[model samples]
Target: MNLGARHPGTEAAWATGEYIRHELERAGCRVWTQEFSYRGVRLRNVVGVLGEGKGPISLLGAHYDTRRLADRDVSYPTRPVPGANDGDSGVAVLLELARALDQERLANEVWLAFFDAEDQGGIDGWPWSVGASYMAANLPA
Candidate 1:
């Protein structure tokens, strides 16, 4: 889940998207990948939808990207962090929640989105919620 690496770009982002898609599908949800581009770099936003019909759709989202290797740490600024808590942990929680919702047969449509490029461009450039920003911008108006 290291979306921040040397020239990771779309490959790493897509890999994480695939993982989320697989998990959501396993939970009996219809999964879709929303693809977009930022700075000519292809990025993906994974959306898993469960249930159907009208009313407001509830969304749970988390970014699955890590900082570039250059901004990793002070000692090893060029190395990528494990991002267990930063990346995978949130996704894991969401996945579990999706599963639980499925088991309980929730009524409302639940959409789980994993945004890409959220952690890219570093703290100075992209900021913490770039993926959220992307999601907000592209969500149904």
Candidate 2:
């Protein structure tokens, strides 16, 4: 997933979310897509749930979207970075954790959340962490 792009808020985000959902479901967990809004744009948070007990949910999150573009580098500021490390690295790690957790047993409910629009606001604009802010606002208090 290319998290850094002109429109990381586009189909790339959706595709990544879908892929995560597929993997989670394949691992035998129930998955749900949490939809939210960001600067008038619709965003998604893909959630995978494991275990049955309900109390305080343990939530793990990673942003799957990239910046609007690489405005950091002077040579190719307009280009998109692969975001293998920025985008998928944490998600990959969490996926592995989910797999392991599914294989064994857990005492609490685990929610793996892949948030969208996190990379939307880069250095100059609305600022990064959009997805996280949205999630925080929507999460149970």
Candidate 3:
């Protein structure tokens, strides 16, 4: 997947989304991509469904986009973070959970969502959760 920064509307961001989708699909979940726009930037959200039922849906979510600025590091303040834990850890958990759900039996429906452009706030021209808000407003099935 994208090892560099996954800023909004960037190629890296798109790659990141695809990686999540691939992993989810490999884990036996049916996946779909939701596309939306924010501040003239096109963003995508990946949704994966595990098992089938008509009850309350359980949602697992994580932001896959890396922050544009490494404001925490004084030496590399403007550089991008690898996001190994900040972004990858959450995604990794969901992916592994998806795999587990494949073997285990659950009553309710489970949804694995990878939200993009979430860590873009306070820098560049983007805001926090712009992509996520769009996804929430749309709230697809």
Candidate 4:
């Protein structure tokens, strides 16, 4: 609840990324971030990993980007969602899972993917999942 609306390319978003990274590390997960730029906006994807099994990976994902404009709000269509509950709730769940599962002696690797630029759709001049698209296009070997 303390984290504010994490709009893409905003201070809140970056701070949230830092928070997720720190939390992942605190949970004993190997953590890293992927930085990408799309249409002049730079965004990040935070990833946390556990386990050493070298087979297929299991992924848990959540979008962390909040819509910059609450177009559906009757009173303040232009204002951002106060808490971005839809986005942040998933983050909270993943964080809790990361904390809970970090101690398990598992056989399969688990990855927690926090994606950005997911709530940008329908906003003028913005597209959805730009950060995720960039990550998928530039996946690591």
How close to the true structure is residue 43 of candidate 2, measured as C-alpha lDDT? 77
Candidate 2: regions farther than 4 A off: 1-6
Q: Mind giving the per-residue lDDT tens digits that candidate 3 earns over 1-141? A: 545877778888888888888888888888988898777878898989887573688888998888879977889998887788988899899999988875346778888889988887878666788766877788854
Compared with the true structure, all predictions reach lDDT values of 0.71, 0.74, 0.82, 0.83
Candidate 2, which ten residues in sequence have the lowest lDDT sum? 1-10
List of clashing residue pairs for candidate 2: 3-66, 4-66, 5-68
Task: Please give, for residues 12-114, the per-residue lDDT of candidate 2 as tens digits.
Answer: 6777788889999987778887687766676788878888465558888887776667777799988776677777788898888778885345767888888
Give the C-alpha miss distance for residue 6 in model 4, angstroms.
1.6
lDDT by residue (38-93, candidate 1, tens digit) is: 66677777888877553468888887876666474679886775667777788899
Please list the residue runs of candidate 3 whose C-alpha ends up more than 4 Å from where it truly belongs after superposition.
Answer: none
Best first by lDDT, ranked: 4, 3, 2, 1
> In each prediction, how many residue pairs overlap at the backbone (N, C-alpha, C within less than 3 A)?
0, 3, 0, 0
Instruction: Residues 1-141, candidate 4: write the lDDT tens digits.
Output: 476788888888888899999998898889878997767777899998888464578888898888888899999999987654688889899999888884467767888889988888878778777777776787667
